[model samples]
Target: MSLETIIYIIFAGIIALLLALFQYFKKGKNRSKLDLFFSFLRFVTLFSVLLLIINPSFDQIELSIEKPSLVIAVDNSSSIKHLKQDDKTLGFVKSLKNNTELQEKFNVNIFTFGNQLREGDSIDFTDKQTNVHDAFKALSQIYKNTNAPTVLLTDGNQTFGNDYQFVTNSYKQPVYPIILGDTVSYTDLKIQQLNVNRYAYLKNEFPIETILVYNGSERVASTFVVYQGNQKVYSKPLNFSKQDNSKIIHFTLPANKVGVSAYRAEIKPIENEKNTINNIQNFAVEVINEKTNVAIVSDFPHPDLGALKKSIENNEQRSVSIVGVKEFVSKVNDFQLIILYQPNSKFKPVLENLKTLKKNYFTVIGTKTDLHFINNSNLGYRVDITNQKEDYQGVLNTNYSPFYIDDMGFESFPPLLSNYGGVQISQPIDVVLNKSVQNVTTNDPLLFTFEAEGRRQGVLLGENIWQWRAHSYLENQSFHEFDNFIGKFVQYLASNKKRSRLNIDFQSFYNGNSHVIIKAEVFDKNYVFDTREVLHITVKNKGSKTEKTFPLILKNNHYEVDLSGLEPAEYEFSLSTKNDKITKTGSFKILEYHVEQQFLNANAEKLQQLARNSSGTSYFINNANGIIKELLEDKRYVSVQKSSKNTIPLIDWKYLLGIIALSLSMEWFLRKYNGLI
Candidate 1:
């Protein structure tokens, strides 16, 4: 059966023949015929020993009847064709269309990738270049959750993303890579990346940002033009920084519109580069003019009211309203803040109703204040004055700071209050200002406050306005100080009124022939999509001039739009909504349609590595059938068998002596019958 077996047979025969010769030679010896016969028997015993050393065996093996999982991934990029129209690529694909073994073994899912990924039974490769990296990424995402082996069919031309690198990594299953069509030579230019802001200020400079490009050996300079609808807004010359690569470029273009502006950027074709179709980039920008509204409310009018109102009303953007404390109680929630002046005698009635306003209030206390409500109510902390002292005639005027508000030094100014007395602050008062004059007695508390649960209140103990408002050297600048204290507080609260920022996430596929549905999430304040706003979307190939608009209704503040008819290409989408025009812009490169291709190829390669790593041989698809059969039959294929024989000298020869005596008896009988002694 084997070379070793054949050699053993030949050697055994030759040894037997040599034994016969020795017998013949010994028979002719007259000195010791018996000894010669015994020597011949010894030679026979040696031949038997050699036969046993060869160690022959016959084995039967059982193989697995289960079939391995098979996956098919076909390249559905634009370069691949759909029909048999005398095209080489198409012909090759058609020839393999009816592969029954492939069909029976694989649970197939077909996919195409260009600017997006599309899945289907049949697809025409779009006229777009392929990005193999994106294709692999898409496949990885799809099959990452599965444990299936894959079979990938492609042309091996990756015009877009990375390729072949995935094969270098490990996979859970074997990847059977079957390359389709012969690689060909083609020269083309592609725009690698385009970057632009979806939002910009109206009548401001808009940055036209993009990356200049070349794919193969193409070097040329071209003029790039920016178009706003049918009008050409800007044009400039651009040079390819890299002959077979890409370089970044940024230029400012004037944006004079206040709304969504449809724009396209084009580069005149060079010798090797494609025309404006692949060189142009389309996009849209939402120019925003953020508007803000402000309102002011007050209690019993005070001298500081005029100053506060003037400070805010002076700004054209701010709207100031002066409402009585009584009127504020009715519409308090309408305004940002409620400013209350020194109350009359008792504050119980006002403080009782204060809890119903549902708004933060700033209360200022004057000389003649009511202690009944302050001492009894939960809204304002109680205050008491100890020393009955008079204010200095000319006090050293310094900065007047609130408890938590910042303090800026003020020069000497006329004293607003004469014969003023400092008052004792309560435990609720968080901080205290310094006493600039000795007249600041225990009778008057400069600043004190009461903080309610869920509501904030600021109470100024002493009201001396004429000095700080009129005589201060910063003349009209005290407004900044007053505004800062109130501004930060109100703005901070307003910001917290809404929840996290809005964001949407989703996935899509584009087969070169069919349009992939474009879907995304629409998140709003509190995830409540009740704005009824209209979301406008503009989609364009990354570097191609072809562009399309898709409008969706922001229902319940969430949106999902579909773009059903489109060819495979690299696309960038710009989104804008009516309320907030500057929305989200996303870029997605579609993958060629292929099923199981990536996984099978990845798995096959892994299986090959497994075999090699373990001192086994890798097999191809054509060889898998026979190789598996052979491996299953050979037990050595699973593991090496340790030799069971051991050599040693034995003293037990009783059985051999018995056999020798029986043979001698038979020989003697034969010799006696032949009439020989």
Candidate 2:
């Protein structure tokens, strides 16, 4: 307590004593043992009340020891069971969790990871995919800014995410990896990867690329074959040794029939090969008879025109032709979709022709675009533009429902240049991307789509989209994602299908390991999205002649059904509404491919490198005991003693108020009993 508080307390006591004395011995009052007792009660009551008014506070100190965190991350992917190490992985984790000394020294937190990270020790080892990078990412967030040492139990054969070896630097904790699976090397021939387009034109040859790898020192000869059902369509002899262990095979196959076609690529395994499951791979492609032809009409040449053409034509079922405004007017009817690039006064004839013919077109606006011309053209939207140009980045509109599109890291893409303006859409539209300037998002649409009368139209309020394609390639080292996005946009505008009450979105083919989810949207008579309607899907396996039905659960703005439990085969499904007779039917094929079962042995080198980068050691399953001893001996992970101090006020103590009341009550009773009121 401070000196001021001490002085106040002393004065309070002196005043109480003086009052007690005056009450007991004033003038003619007689003094007795009872009087003394009454005086004592008054002194206590008055002094306590005064002390409460002062409300002096004292300091209290508390000490506590905070133990360091010990995270145990187990890989629960199917690769562990494929390698015959599930039981060993489980036993190691159980023993580690039950260790008394380690538990007492550190806070033990256990987690299991397959495609994602989950807390706890429930290990059934039935996960279909492995993503070690995501597991570390989650752990880094859970144990950030703490002394947490992680013990990773896995076979180090990741099949579903970014390379875990490259992401070790992101996590600051020490990672001791317990390597599972056999370390012995075996002569193996496997098909590493296969790439083919999702769709092919009927009667055309579709290209296929296959990468073959051998993992043995000795020379080996094998036959690579491509099969459709039970018949072999193509074959080649392949030779591999230590120096030439990899080969890239590229070929084309004729798509004679128009439907979902499943094919298998196999590299015949050598004799005595232990793991032959990886020698064969399955893929599928859909053949369609229709093709979308797009024409780009521009007054002058620009890189954006080329980029759009390449992206749209990436799908084998689409083709693009670029022409000048005058030339396009002659061949306007030849193409299904028209792309008007920065339309100005010279393109007035082309725009009028498109409107008259009721043809769908995509308008791309930029600095060269004439806003006055657009305002008078009656394209369902108008933009009030100024002389200044603005650089606007793209922000994805997650609620867009016209069709499904992935984010594809749009936030990191470079900005596009456009005239400074406010856009006003006169009709109902769905915005795929909104405008963001300097990181602040606006309500204006950057890329949007709308339907008028019986025709569909798409608009982009900016140019320089070529930069987006380039940036996408730089980030992912591929242009497939960017191309697929543009292809979907073109596909929507090229089709002449009218608006329907029931719409379903799904792919024609799916890999066995992928999630088979179908989304549906139902509309009422007035064409408004109806959420009260119940939806159901009836699926029939074409090969097995089995049928199953499932109810579609209502989501935020659509209905969804997960068909992941269905086995790999050709399926024909029909979606119907519960109250109405509206139904939509489609067929899709599921290829038989399990990425987790392709590994022959553990990826020991990469795991060792990961351990070295994180300042930890790598050990085999048999010698995993060393990890416990090492963690116990590590000096950096120790308990820290922390102290805290608090100042508590005297009035805050509830018992002081009780004591004051009791003393006052007792004094009043004594006075009343003695007839001294």
Candidate 3:
């Protein structure tokens, strides 16, 4: 309230009081104590109402006490037990949590993490992977902008995820990392890496690249062997004279058998090597008798050729060859399916030969494509080209189904360049993707596939597929969406199988470290998704002859089962339905490989780097008691001071209305008692 406003309010109260006194006490009639009190109540209520009309606000200061948080983050991964330090690490964690001094100074929160972070003191050491960077990142997120000091404990041997040094430096806190495990390197012979294709054609030669690493022994003399089952296929002598050396071995093996075959590459373990689990590694490659050859016949080189080729080859059963117009005539007969890229003026002879062979083809309509010529040829569809070119994106057609790829809803992906006019289809076309122009979805087919008069054809009305693949990766952090789209198209064209109500698709082989997933799609007789039933699958371990049955769960318009924790062995699977009685059978092999055991020595350098980056100190696990004493003595990481202010309006106080009502009620009672109504 200002001085002028306060003076006006006081003068108004006096005038209102005089009016009330005059109205009630004129000629001093009925002038009793009760009348005087009634007069006083009327005067007070009128003055308070006049003040409320002014509506002033005032600031209120509030005090609060906030204790700074202290985060004790511990690594509870399987690597601790593998390094023979689980008992000591557990004891240290228990002691830190029960420390009275740390509890009194700040709110100490204990957390355990491996693949993800969790709050607790239970250290089970069962996590299969360790990610030190994730632990630091989790702490930073939970204690953001607070005066928090984090204590990290680990052997610093990160098996997965990015380097921890970056997160520790950016944590904005004092980090004290208690280094565990033996820092000294031990004598060991390890298979550092085994790289092989997951699938190969029957009777074709495939290559396996193996890198053998030796660290401790100066003279590493051993025999390297590659075998499948009990039969050894290849053997060589390995020798390293230096303390550290990486020997690369490449094996060209013939895929003789037609099934999932597991190959083991091993180095004969030395007598003094303490850790020999990493000496052997298993990898599998499925050899299939049926190989689908797909050729990309192009007039000129475009980046789309490379993108399409990579995605098509993701299926081991399919092989892609990029053939130019000059060489395509001789190579077209070798391919089961052909992808014609803008059949230009030079493709007249090629198109005639394609019709003679009666082979199915997928065509792309580009700027240079002769739409008029294509209209004459029977590729199932034609487009009218104009001088003006427009950019268009794909809008998925919900009803199209020769084979289905997962849907990508309108999410603002980059557009493909098309001629301004549009496409005109004269055949029975199953349009999979429509043209979405300027945020409006049109009925024009961007891509379609149809089988007409014993000829199967697929076509898309755009180019720049390289950009589509790159955009798919940016959208979902993987090239799976683009690859699935291409793979389904190729599969539909390469094989003319009778349609089934139930279908299952999975890899024939998988690395043991990766997640083993089997996907399924079920449709009713009307060809719509059948989502009202539970699909059961019986999984049997080939070696043990034991079986386990589980129901596949539906997600994202499909059914999938995650066989993650199954043993590293060959497994046979059978899926079944209830009333329909539909059954599907398949088998897959899981290769045995453990990446964590390759390292025999603790990574002390990374732990030391984290300490230096965060302005803290490092200590061995046995000498880690200094961490608590130093943290207590350091005053830099202490509680913070904070304050807040708020402004309150007088109208918000409902008790003021209660006071007015009470005053009016009292005035009424007093007047009635004094007979002055």
Candidate 4:
């Protein structure tokens, strides 16, 4: 309390005392014991009222001891069970959590991770995949600003995601890894990796690549063979020792039949090999009979032409031919899709031929493009151009449903150059990317698609798209994402199929470890997407002669069904609507592969490196007592004394008001009873 508050309290007491004296010792008042009691009551009531009127506040201090957090992240993937360490892992975690010293010194938090991170001690060890990198990332975010040391318990075998060893650099807390599984090296022969294209042309030879590895000191000889169903198609003798332990085998197989074909590659394991499961691998490819031929017709050469050709031809089933407008006019009927690059008066003949034949074409407009010719071309759109050029960036439309396309971080791509203009479309169109200028998004289409008279047409309002491809590679170190985006657009244009009420999208082959999802879209009579329709799919296993039916759940703007429970075999499926008679049929194959069962031993070196990088120690599960001792001895993770101060009212208003009301009521009753009122 301040001096001003103290002075106010003194003055309030003096006034209360004076009022009590005046009430009892007035000029004609009698001096009696009852009068004294009444005076006392008046003094108490008056003093409380004055104190309440002042309402002074005082500072309150509180102290607490904050203990450092200790996070325990356990691996709950299937690989743990494959290595026969699930029970041992569970026992270790239970014993650690029950330790009295740990409970008293730190706040213990338990987590489990497989495909994702979850909080609990429920360790079923049934997860299909292991992602140690994601586990570390999630833990770093959860305890970013706190002193939380993590205890990672895993085999250090990640089936998917980025390398886990390098992820330790971003983590601020120390990570003590308790390695699981046997670290002993055995005489193991394994197929490290296999590479094959998804699609192959019928009657053509498709390339297959395999990498074989051996992990024994003694020299061994084996036979590497590939089988198509029950018949052996290829074989080679392989020799390996400690020095020469790896070999790359490349060969080609003929795709004589047009369907999904499954193949298995095996490296015969040497005698006394303990883990033979890693010796065989399965793969599949679809033999497609039809191929798409796309032509790029331009008046002059540009880098965009070469970029388009390379991106489109990344898939083995599609080919791109770059030709001038004069050469392309005569060969218009040879290609299914035509790409017109920066069309001007020279493209008049090409555009006329496309219009006459009702062929699909994609138009790309740039600064060099003649706006007057484009405006008079009657291509369902007109641009009122200006003499100025503008660099505009692209913003993706999340609602685009013509085909599934990811965002791919389009906002960071380099801007494209185009003439400043007001674009107007005369027909209904789907805008995939909108125009953005100077960080402000505009209601203009940068890339759009429309259909007219049974033909599809795509229009891009800018150029310099080659830079977009290069930027994508710089970001991801691969052109797969950008090329896939272009492939979807080209696939939509190359197909001459008429618009239908139902469209289905799926793959012809899937690995057993991957999810088999089929997506579908339904349209009403007027060609508008309908969300009220119900869909279902019936699948028939060709090998087992078994049938099953599943309902398709409605997702965002589409319906989908997951067939991940199906066994590895050839299967045919039919999709049908509930209210209408619309149906579509397709077939797919799932290859036999188990990624978790391929490991022979634990990855101890990477885990040790991870511990070293994070300033922690690595230990085996059987000898992990040193970790607890070290954690207890570490001085950096000690408890911190935290204090906080707050200003609070000295008197509670409720109790003060009660005291004042009780005194006033008692004094009034006493005066009335004595007939002194």
Q: What's the lDDT for residue 621 in model 1?
A: 34
Residue 542, candidate 1: C-alpha displacement in angstroms: 24
Q: For residues 1-677, write the lDDT of model 4, one tens digit per residue.
A: 89999999999999998999897878464577787788889999999989988988878899999999999999998888999988889989998899999999999999999889999889999777889998888888999889998999999999988898978678889999999987898889999999999899999999999999999899999999999989999999999999999999999999999988889999998999988888989998889999989999888889999999999999878999999988898888889999999999999999889989999999999988999999998888998777999999999986665666667889999999988866999999989999999978899999999889889999999999999999999988799999999998899888877767888988998897788999898878876677899999999999988999999998867788999878889899989998887999999988888888888778999999999999888999989878888999999899999999988775764788888999999999988988878
Task: List the candidates' TM-scores in order.
Answer: 0.36, 0.84, 0.82, 0.83
Query: Which 10-residue window of candidate 1 scores lowest in summed lDDT?
Result: 395-404
lDDT of 3 at 545: 99
Off by over 4 Å in 2: 1-62, 217-219, 299-316, 320-323, 385-401, 404-448, 462-487, 579-581, 644-677
lDDT of 1 by residue, 347-413 (tens): 4444555576555666665555554445555454555543233332222112111212333333243
As for TM-score, the candidate ahead, 3 or 4, is 4
Model 4 alpha-carbon drift over 4 Å, by segment:
1-65, 299-307, 390-401, 407-417, 436-442, 466-479, 579-581, 642-677
**Which has the higher TM-score value, candidate number 2 or candidate number 3?**
2
lDDT, model 1: 0.50
TM-score of 1: 0.36
RMSD of 1: 27.3
The lowest-lDDT stretch of 10 consecutive residues in candidate 4 is 398-407
User: lDDT per prediction?
Assistant: 0.50, 0.90, 0.81, 0.90
Candidate 4 C-alpha error for residue 217, in Å: 2.4
- Report the C-alpha displacement of residue 552, candidate 1, in angstroms: 11
